[model samples]
Target: MSTPTSSSSSSIWVLSNIKLQFFARIRRFLQSKATRKRCEPSDRFDTAKNKTEPDNKVENFETVQVTEKHKEKEEEEEEEESVIMMQRTVKMLHFGSWEEKEVAVKEIEKLAKEDVKVRKLITELGVVPVLVSMAVSPVNSRRQAGLTALIHLADGTYTNKALIVEAGILSKLPNTIDLVDESTTSKLAELLLSLSSLANTQFPLASLDFLPLLRNILETGSRSFDTKQCCLGALYNLSTVLENAGPLVSSGVVPFLLEVSSVKEVSEKALATLGNLSVTLMGKKAMENSSMVPERFIEILSWEDKPKCQELSVYILMILAHQSSLQRKKMAEAGIVHVLLEVVLLGSPLAQKRAMKLLQWFKDERQTRVGPHSGPQTPRFAMGSPVNQIEAKEGKKLMKSLVKQSLHRNMEIITQRANAAGESSKLKSLIISTSSKSLPY
Candidate 1:
């Protein structure tokens, strides 16, 4: 019933509205799909970037760890190289030209001074035998270098000293001692002294004809002071063993020591060696027979600058005093009692004790001589008893003379000590009072 134009217009309006709504829906759907694609790719890219970041961090951590390990390995290699270098230096001591050998030995000496480990290494490398060979070489410079190296090597631990001894250095050293110059001889003697410090080394040394060599060196006036000191030191060390005592006495060491007993440089050591030698019975007898022994001991005992010598000389005299009655008589006749009494008053405590013991022994001996005897008895009322009186008178005279001489000697010493120490009045009064009241005679 409506008009046709109005209806048509209404139908067209409805169609246009439907078309616009449908197109808007289609455009919105397409735009959502495009946004979804873009967001998915962005999420994948962010995920890949996160994964790559950790991998890079792990790679950096591994690089740092690997670098530290590499550095540690380098340090180890360097330490090993140093040890190898030290070993090569030791080995270079042999199988070289004279100059090269000299250089090698000096280098070894340098290493030897490093520490005990290097010294033991040098010993184990069998360098000692080659050094011994080089020590006896014809070239003076090489010989000196070899001896110097041995000196340093032997200055190590006991194992090092034994290594040198086992190397047959004792046998080779005696012959070379005479052929070398004074400097080399001194070094050799020093080496020997070091070797002799260990126990049981002296026997082989003596058997290797070293005793005579040492005696010759000591007796030679032309030797260096260091050589003489070293020789005396060696002898002193060797004579400490009781078995070597007799051999030393018989090998003319006693005479040589006595001859050099006055040498200021070696006198103390010489007296010490003699004291060691006198520790045995055979040595005691030898010393008792030597007139020079008591005389030298007395001289040393009176020295003001050498208190050690005084103590040692007193010790030797005490030993000799205990040997036999005849020896005691000889010591007393040699005017030893006054010296012993003086030392009892003025010497060190040990010396004082020894001097007192000897004096007591002398007193006991005198008492025994004058005491009643259990043997066959003689009547005291005999007319010829004048003989005993005369003998007693002579003994008193001898005793008085000894005491006077001792007093005079002590006064001189006291005066010297007082003047040196600026204590003249106090010491002189003290000595005067003590000597007056303390004379046992």
Candidate 2:
């Protein structure tokens, strides 16, 4: 009986301890689960919201959104404001008082310069016609303001430029440019420069009003060279059209160009126009008529520092000299051959090439020269001549021989230079192998 009671009591104690350990393990698992849940965002929000049960628990159901679409709304607002401003500007430009019109045009000019799109846009508002009309306004300040606006409107857009011409700016020009001051004259010249591109198309830029105004400004010694350069640019553009040549020459542009091209400041532009005119019959004839032709041009060719001027001058001479004996004789008498030799020695490559070609013509003239000869002629022998015919002829032949040899030597030097320039062997040999006979004359 005693052994049974002791065994039963021991078993009961062991069962109670096992139950307590199992409950502790369950409690540890539950604590770990609670810690992990609290680490989540929703659980943290719930814990922070309220210590009062489910009533104070937080749940946010508001739908969230990114608000970047406001830019489209802002652009729409800007567009509306721009339209209102343009309408106001156009109204003020069209029917406003002189002061209002002046203000409007300046605004147009400023707007046009901002963007090409703005230029095209403002042009659609009919600002060009009003600006052009104001260009001819008798009031000098109004005129300058108008011209300034048009120049900006016509800046880089071809369509805007075309619209300006189509607005009859040509017809509206004041007959007397002298009525305007130098500042207004300069502005007008700049406008013409911008509008000169119309000459390249079918548009008629050679109206009676156009060339006269250009000539007036260009001829005025009081006008600055900057203004003159702008006028020259206009003249050059107009001269590009073949039909404009007759009127250009008839306008007495040749004499003025000859006078101005001598000045180094405007020489290149004036010469370039002369080069264009030289291609036309009237232009060639007009230049030939000028006492300044080969002499003025020959003087210009000596400008080594002004290489482009030299090039243009030589180009005009080439045109004038081709198949024209009268001009060539005048050139020879005016000491053109010496100039050509100088050009051959010291000039741009294109200048050198052109000079050599002109020289070849003179050389051919020398080789085939008969009674009244070519190259550069010496003084003639009278009937009772001091120079005996045999002696003179022999001396002439010997001098020709020396010249020929000197030409051969100079050509050899040129070949050596070509060699040093890293030219191809075939070209080098072609130059090197050339005999004196192969030289001009």
Candidate 3:
């Protein structure tokens, strides 16, 4: 008997796309029939009728051949599907031209814009170090695209916050803040904005040593006005995260802002940011010590077009309102009332509300100075409305209550107003006391 050939053996058994088994098996069967004197398949099967008659519309021979071809085609299709599935299972890396990169960026943006996908992609891509490297690349376009992608990744998700912070993204902030060169605007500004959005995150902003770096940017005279504006925006956002960011802000930011305001060439954003940060830090104790409020802030009160600057003046007055009646008397003596009244009258609803609040805080500042009502050396009260007496009796307590509400309603607004108005380290007390619950007769 003849042996089965490898090719026929492969074709005979559908050995998972391995060909040749079927032909081998057929050859073995034929040899066995010949050796044993068995009838041939053609003779046993009536070969002429089987080969020539039609099974359906076609001849039997053609039908059988077509059926076998169809089975092979199906098997090939399944193999192709398996290969495609394997390709999808692997992590994909894309590289291409600027246009292609932009298309990829747009696709990522589309995914991220969906909100749900942003939260998802951050978790999946969190461990990929290329994302971080791209964010810090020397190439501005690549760097911006990376940062924009990262901001979406971290938006409002605490899980993502932990991941990116652990990935050393926070460590890159100092370098971002230090980029004062004009050519880096697209990259640095994008990075700075991303860092700013992290303000509400749990990522320990103070630990990054960002304050000193930001202070360097704000205080350095060699940088341009645009750089200063960017630094101030970052600083303003950062102040929300940092509890006692007053001294750094106070030591020189106020003076720098005043200088910027005086310059015809200074960017308006720089001055506006300066004003915003001044108001944010106003009520903190450290800021009070910085003594940032003396004269220049008083000067901005008169600039009619700069409503933001005027708002800053009002905020400073509100913080300094914490000083004793003698201090208010001193401020009034220093000509603060004129500019403050201007702020009180201008602006939209939020501005008007802020102005009224500051007005209330300023009017009630009498409690800061109290001698026994009958003492011979007692400071004479400033002549004003009955509100002054009510304020002296209940102002600090009421101011403290208002502070609690402000903290609850929006700590950011109060903080920003304080910083922009130039209140350095002074923060209004956040603690609430039950003592004010029942008015004492």
What lDDT does model 1 reach? 0.70
Which of candidates 1 and 2 reaches a greater TM-score?
2
lDDT value, candidate 2, whole model: 0.76
lDDT string for model 3 (82-134, tens) is 33432232123233455455445545644566676435543453222445666
**Leading candidate by lDDT:** 2
**Model 3: lDDT of residue 386:** 84
> Which has the better TM-score: candidate 1, or candidate 3?
1
Residues 1-441, candidate 2: write the lDDT tens digits: 999999978765664465445445545655575455434544455565566545423223111111222443465557556655666777788768999998888778777779987787677656787888888888877888889989998898878888888888877786556667889988988988988988887665646458888888888899999999999999999898898898889888889999999999999999999999998999999999998888999999888779999999999998888768788879878978767765775578899888887776665454333233323333355677655555567755754564455555566554565466564463444455344344333
For each candidate in turn, the TM-score is 0.69, 0.70, 0.46
Local lDDT at 19 for model 2: 43
List the candidates ranked by TM-score, beginning with the highest: 2, 1, 3
lDDT of candidate 3 at residue 290, scale 0 to 100: 42
Q: List the residue pairs that clash in candidate 1.
A: none
In candidate 2, where is summed lDDT lowest over 10 consecutive residues?
60-69
- Cα lDDT, model 2, residue 357: 77
